[model samples]
Target: MPASGPPDQGEGKRRPLTALEDGYHIVTTLGSAATVLCATAFPIWLSRVRDNARALSGQSPRYARPWLYAGWIVPVANLWVPRGIVADIHRASAPGERLPHAVNWWWGLWLAGMPSGTGLMYAVPTDHVIERAYRQVYPLLAADAAVVAAVVAGVFVVRALTAAQRRRGVDSVRARPTAEATGRA
Candidate 1:
């Protein structure tokens, strides 16, 4: 049987988490999953704001709500479509003002990091040699790190846009005009 309990914390000392079978991997996986899940919500909320702000300002969103979700899931198109969405939101919200530097930085990180993250995540080793796997881990780690950074940048993008909308006095989700209000059935 496999030795039970955390390994090598000394007899009286508490064992490390790794002592539990798969504990470290499970924790890491859960952390990564939670981080990605939280990151996913940023765009959804931002898109709602983007469209609402546009509608309030008498403009149409660059893409439909579905397109915003698609932009994240689609491969090559993700690179530009999402960026276009942000740019459109900025144009609508800020009008003549210069977009905050955060917008450009967020877009740049996303454009660059996403491809790198995908490449690293999808690249597989030809051989099972331990050394090769160890060597590969560094680049994979770097790419994953970049992906995390890009996720953080996404939040900054949302913040800047949200702040811009506030500055434009477009802070609320302006309700759609009713049929009666618009004089149509």
Candidate 2:
């Protein structure tokens, strides 16, 4: 019999990744890392803000402290819990005021970006994404747009909430009677 190369390394052997493929891998890795970081950090920040809002408004917390983090991961509950948490914060911070439009926009865009074909949740491999990018880039672009819009709206929501909290805090402080006024001096 004639000598032959290893069967495993012959016709069925995998080709080396191209530079572009390597770049895609790097981008995917970075994106996953960023997602993880955000996933971990956002809950902590939200928890703190939720506490502050509750204190400022002196209203009962609509959701428990754990929900600040758990709501994002729980199925079905995630659909409304996270939004409710933010809404509660805003409502508490600015009682009798309308909820900020940015809150609704942010949540809507964020939900719109969650599809596997479009948003951060890619059900396919990187190779598939690259392939799809060539033929159907619009879905990817739309997803990116949704995420970007969500981010902008989220910033507005945070700003509105912070400003409302600040105003509430100041008002509370001002409403308190001084020791002299209360004859406690």
Top candidate (lDDT): 2
lDDT tens digits, residue span 1-185, model 2: 01322212345573455666678679778877877787777676677667777676677788987888788878889889999999998887788999999999999998887763432455666766765665687987787688778878988987887777666543232234335445575
Candidate with maximal TM-score: 2
Q: How close is every model to the real structure, measured as TM-score?
A: 0.67, 0.76
Candidate 1 lDDT by residue in tens digits, 100-133: 7766777776666655443323443222212233
Clashes of 2: 0
lDDT of each: 0.63, 0.72
Give the count of colliding residue pairs in each prediction: 1, 0
Off by over 4 Å in 1: 1-24, 118-133, 175-185
| All candidates: CA RMSD (Å) | 9.1, 7.7
Predicted candidate 1, C-alpha RMSD? 9.1
Residue runs of model 2 more than 4 Å from their true location after superposition = 1-13, 117-124, 170-185
Q: How much lDDT does candidate 1 score?
A: 0.63
Error of 2 at 34 (Å): 2.2
Poorest 10 consecutive residues by lDDT, candidate 2: 1-10
- Error (Å) of candidate 1 at residue 132 is 6.7
